[model samples]
Structures are given as structure tokens and as C-alpha cells.
Target: MMNNKISVREVLVEDAKALLQIIPIIDKETEFTLRGEGEFRLSLHEEESFIRNILAEPRSVMFVASCNDNIVGSLGFRGNNLTRYKHTGEFGMGILKQYWGQGIGTMLIEHLLSWSEAHDIRKINLKVVETNIRAIKLYERFGFEIEGVQKNEVKIADQYYNLLSMGKFI
Candidate 1:
């Protein structure tokens, strides 16, 4: 059982250390994400700089979910700087394994959709490993549709997994 309430909010520079700490843990817990165990190696200063950059970018935003002020999950949207593609962006998210099935991902997506609409974002897209049915279902519940598939896109554990491209129009 969870010991505290879960909340989602815009990420802050102060979250750099906690964010950095949780990311590799989540990576080790799941294969759905692109990164694997021991693959995330961002220094504290670099993480702080990254949060600052995201905060300064008009077309990009990042949010983190906390349980009792402990960062447990994160969601981020990366929009294009080019005027022609500024209305569209791709998002990626991750949550700690223990928090799964507790509506944390849903909370993050709701927050992202609300923020995207206010920021004039017309479309959002994401790519997921084909074997990740749980994530695919979550995205589909939020109105994302599979637009295409990239065969043999990611090779993990000596096996290749297809990547599904999904998008939603706001």
C-alpha cells in the first residue's frame, strides 16, 4: 500500500537530484522504456541544466509525480522549434514499478493534455515497444491511435521488438 498521497506538478530545478535518482531505478524495473538498467548516467549538474532548458523552452514541458514529495514518475513533451512543426510534439513517460495500477500514469497524461491544450499544441505523438501492451492500452485509453509500426526497431535481450508510433489530435 502507498504511504502517502500522489500528486503531479510541473518539474522544478530542485527536483534534479531526486529525478536523477528515480530514473535509473525505474529503468532497472522495466523494459518498456528505451533505456535499460545502468544505462541512465546523467550527472547532477547535467540534470539541473536539463530541467532549466526544459523550463526555458516554450514548446517543451516536463512534469513529475510525487508521493509524499518523493519523485516517483516523470512525463515530458518535446515539441519542435521550427514554426511548421511547432504544433506537434512527442511525449515520453515513466513510473516506478510499485506505483503501477494506481492511476499515476493517468494523472500525468491528464496533466499533459491540459497543458498541451493551453499551449496551442494541436497533436501529440509517442512511440512504444510493440511488446508493451500495458503502455499501449494506456495510451489508447487517452485517445492515441497507432499510426504506423517500425519493424525490428529495438533489440533487447538478443531479440528485436517492433516499435509502434501513435498520435492524437488535440
Candidate 2:
């Protein structure tokens, strides 16, 4: 059954401790992600500082998904700072390996779309490893279209993979 109890909300500064523990785990769990296993080496204090800074940014938003009070996923948007690119935002997300295919990613994307539109973001962009068909399909379902592909953009364990650049105009 789907975990209807999963709760998603904007991340808070106080959530840093729990986030620090989970971020690296989630990063290592997904080969489709930019970071490979054990590459996320941020310390607790650094994570807290980063979280505080992100929370303070008016153009940025980060949300976490939790089930039974345990965090399982994260989605974030980083808006371009230059006035020329203010209307564009970049997205990044990851869910625990165990939670894959459970619809949590869809929930996060839906929330992101609603939030981005409300914030006056005109374009939302994301890069997906070409081999990650699941993620590509998910983005396509949410109206994101592939704009181009960067050949050999991602190298994992000495093997390179293309990266698909996608964007959604709201």
C-alpha cells in the first residue's frame, strides 16, 4: 500500500541534525545521482550552517519527506541570483533507495510545481542521468521536456553516461 502518512514540508534550520544523518545515506543509495557512494562528506556544523543559509534565501526552497517522523526524501530548488536569470530555477532531489517506486518522488515534484508557480518562477530546470529512465519518465509526466543532452557528462566508476537537460515553463 502507498504510504499516505508520508509528510512533506519545507525544511527548517532545526532539521539539520536529522538531515545530516540522512543526506549522505540517500546520496550513496542512488547511482543515478551526481554524488556517488560516500562522496557527501559534510560535517554536522557545516550542514547546519548550509541549512540556515538556504532557509534564509528568498529565491530558494528545500523540502523534506518523512514517514513516521523519519526523513526519507529531499527536494530543493536553487534559483539563479543574477537579475537576468531570476526567473529560472534548478531542481535536485533524492529519495531513499527503499522508497523508490512508492510515489514519493511524484509527490515531491507536484509540490515543487505548485510552489514554483506561486513564487513566480517561470522556468524550472533539472538534469537527469540518461540511464535513469524512471526519473526521466517522472519528469516527463510533470510536463518537463528534454531540451538537450550533454554527451558523457556523468562518469561513474570510470563509465560515462549522457545527461539530459530538461526544463518546464510554468
Candidate 3:
């Protein structure tokens, strides 16, 4: 989806280097994810290896949103490897806090859902901090429903928070 000069597309292996550089920054700048600042510590080689694995997976995808060639956001899905769970997938996404509320989140989810449907994935699952009301609302807008809550699943700083388990079936 394109609006206000933001572009989204599948990430390529060559993007691993740039992605590795920016991922930690994004993690550090966002409080809505499982990882806190500087928690996503990975060597360049490790990140490259990880990206290669994601690229090699037949039922997984990583999409990035960019503005002027700088990566601003990412959304991804990983399908289950087990034969019995092959029809299911899990997703994760994050946008640079500075770029929030520009409709980028909606575009990412839309892209993933369309890709999931085309890939024949029947179910998609995700988890969000219960306090992340904006993300919860966005997911709900796209048909995701809360299935359960893991009480006190995340502890940030001096406080604990619940994690909302959400899913959507195509």
C-alpha cells in the first residue's frame, strides 16, 4: 500500500545487512514488544543467517516499509513446520515509533493477510501487549479476535502487563 510516499514490499536477502542495523534501533525505541531496549543482540553473521533461513522457508515472508530507502517498518509471517500444523502461521510486526499513525500498520497487515490467503494458510496467530490498544484495534479491524489472555505475561520496567492472544482464520 502507498500513501504519503511510504512503500511496502517483500524483503530480500541483500536487505539483511541494513535490516540488522535497524532492527535493534526499532527494538530499542518501541515499548510495545516483548523485547526491551538492546535486547535483540545479534551479530551480523547471525542476523544474515537468520535472514537466509527466512528466505529459504517456503511458507514464510518478511515485508518492510521504506521511505527514501530507509527501512521504517517490518511485518512477517512464519508458517508451522510440522506437517499437522502446516496450515497455521504466526506473525510479528513493528514500525519505527516516529512513523506511527500514518496508516503503515494497516498496510502491513493487509499485505500479510493477502499473502496468507494466497499461500493457503488457514489461520494466523499473534500476540500483543494488552495495553497496546492501537495495535489491538488495528488487528480487530482486520478480523482478528482475541482468543485468550496470558495474565501478567510481560514485565516492563516496574510494571507487569497481560499479553492478548489473538487469531484470524481465512
On lDDT, the candidate that comes out on top is 1
C-alpha lDDT of residue 19 in model 3: 81
Task: List model 3 lDDT by residue over 124-163, tens digit each.
Answer: 9999999899999999999999999999999988998999
Q: Where is the poorest 10-residue window by lDDT in model 2?
A: 1-10
The local distance difference test score of each candidate is 0.94, 0.88, 0.87
Question: Which of candidates 1 and 2 reaches a greater TM-score?
Answer: 1
Angstrom error at residue 68, model 3: 2.0
Instruction: List the candidates ranked by TM-score, beginning with the highest.
Output: 1, 2, 3
Query: By TM-score, is 2 or 3 better?
Result: 2
Error of 1 at 104 (Å): 0.4
**Candidates ranked by lDDT, best first?**
1, 2, 3
Worst 10 residues of 3 by lDDT: 1-10
lDDT of 2 at 1: 42
Better of 1 and 2 by lDDT: 1
lDDT (tens digit, per residue) of candidate 1 on 49-160:
9999999999899999998878899999998878899899999999999889989999999999999999999999999999999999999999999999999999899999
TM-score of 2: 0.95
lDDT against true structure, model 3: 0.87
